[model samples]
Target: MIATDTLDTPAAVGSSAPAATPALPRGLAGTPDDKEMLRSAVELTRDIATARPEVYWPDMLLSAGLGYAALAGAILIGNPVLAALSGVVSALALYRALLFIHELTHIHKNALPGFRFGWNLLVGIPMLTPSLMYEGVHTLHHARTRYGTAEDPEYLPLALMKPWSLPLFALVALLLPIGLLIRSAVLVPLGAVIPPLRRLVWERASALSINPEFRRRPPEGEFARMVFWQELGASAWALFVMWWSATHSWRPLLIGIAVISLTALLNQIRTLVAHLWENEGEAMTVTGQYLDSVNVPPPALLAPLWAPVGLRYHALHHLLPSMPYHSLAEAHRRIVRHLGVDSTYQKGNYSGLLPLVGRLARSTMLPR
Candidate 1:
């Protein structure tokens, strides 16, 4: 899930209004009494947090390979029916592959070196979402003091907003490709030439954030060099896309951008229901965070496609942020079997996305 982030400035290019002053949702706004149990459940899942290359590498490779293949087929075949078909397939696969950025943040720096490099080289640069965009931003979302507060870069209570806000929130993904392109091609290189503009671009353009007010500081040391190279790679790719469009053909680049746009849209839909969106800028307990978040359990097979890469267990990931993606399901199962359906650990589970999103939409319509 691309977590909700509140921007301080005007909403980014495709966004609706800057997040309005947040209102407290009417239900479940306080700390839960079962904090200890939630903590214990998280502790129990800690053992499974180790990243395994065999598991991570195959999924990453296959998703990237299939996604590029589908896009290539779309461009080469030049049939409207096949193009649309392949575009959807490409979007799904690429979205899943790109989500590994979330894993990269949570994984220890020493782990998954090859996956890191390969992901940045393929999906990250091509999609214009290199790891640097997420590296420093995501950790703030997990901070205990900041999780649901105004200070948290990745949180906004969409359920508490006006009814009109829902569509804007979900549809903003359609605008991300244009926004990212301008940020990389125009802003990044320009910033390098003009020293003072560097900070402005870094804060406003560097991260894939929802928070307009969140300012990313300049990277230092080795990470600084990595950010420079990543930006160069994306900028170069952006130029190549332009060159391809001008010289040989626009079909390939257009299809690639279409896939990226669709990837963002699908991710936006997943973000919409990742949580209840119930936090009202309050400091939430570990239990509060779990209850305020959500999971779509078994038999909801479509959950995997929409919320791929263990995002189907979003609430559980929040509970045990260190747990690897492959291990989330087992951790969830163990908690359910040991703690039973009625456990506070299970409070975040939802039957499906529709009810959760519907209930949130309805909640915002009624007077608070």
Candidate 2:
């Protein structure tokens, strides 16, 4: 449940007044764990913990295949209206495929066999967002001691920020395709020769993170080897795309960027509601983290479109991070049935996207 207690900081009533950083309300300062809820979550969903290779392979391949096919239609078709529709389809499909990176992070290296390689080849490298960008980085966001804190790369206190930050957050995603293009095509290649530049890129520009202060440490051992290959593949693909655009018409490349830009916009909007963003750089209890996160469950039919691959149940995800995407729905149903409507579990459930966004916006407007 969201804490109803209010922040006590002085109000920033005028533009001239500097806004003080917001704090988590006293009621939420050190919320105790809901042990019953945590135990039940584990016990109820144990059967569905295994990642199914069959489901993962077909779904990812199909999504990537459809995305590329629609992208081709969008670029080649002369009709403006049809091309626009194709672009939308391509964006949505590719977005879903790209999100499989989340699954890649949680699943064991051996769980899905060559699934990681397949994904990087088909979707990740092509998009210039290889798994290396997320693999080691995202797990920190799930760490019990790091979540919602300054150490968490994927977290920020957005609800405690100025009102304009919300729109700015989503708007920045529109430039992601261009930013990624430069990173892979120019930065990665240049960084290969300049050790300092490579180190800087790895620390600052590698992760898909919201917290500007979080810097990724150097990769080591097996993961370091993985990063090297993934970076090489992404850089090569980016350079090839640049060469193709220079030799051929620029229409295809430009259209592809536009489609990816739409995908990034959709992802950024989804990120806005992924959490309440109320924690003030403090480590949260499991229950606090669950409440801070969100779940847009059944009957809100459009959620799957915006939060695909079981992301609609994001709060539940924090509870069972290792649970495969295909199994989250059933796990949600079982947990909800066991815990009932009034449980802390249900507090994470929300109606739809707009209400959550409005709630975050209103929180930002509260006295700083």
Score every model by TM-score: 0.90, 0.93
TM-score of 1: 0.90
Candidate 2 lDDT by residue in tens digits, 115-177: 999999999999999999999999999999999989999998998999999999999999999
lDDT of each: 0.82, 0.93
Tell me, by TM-score, which candidate is best: 2
Off by over 4 Å in 1: 1-29
- In model 1, the clashing pairs are 4-154, 6-211, 7-211, 7-212, 7-213, 8-212, 8-213
Candidate 1 residue-wise lDDT, 211-248, digit = tens: 66777877999999999899999999887777778898
Q: For candidate 1, which ten residues in a row score worst on lDDT?
A: 1-10
lDDT of 1: 0.82
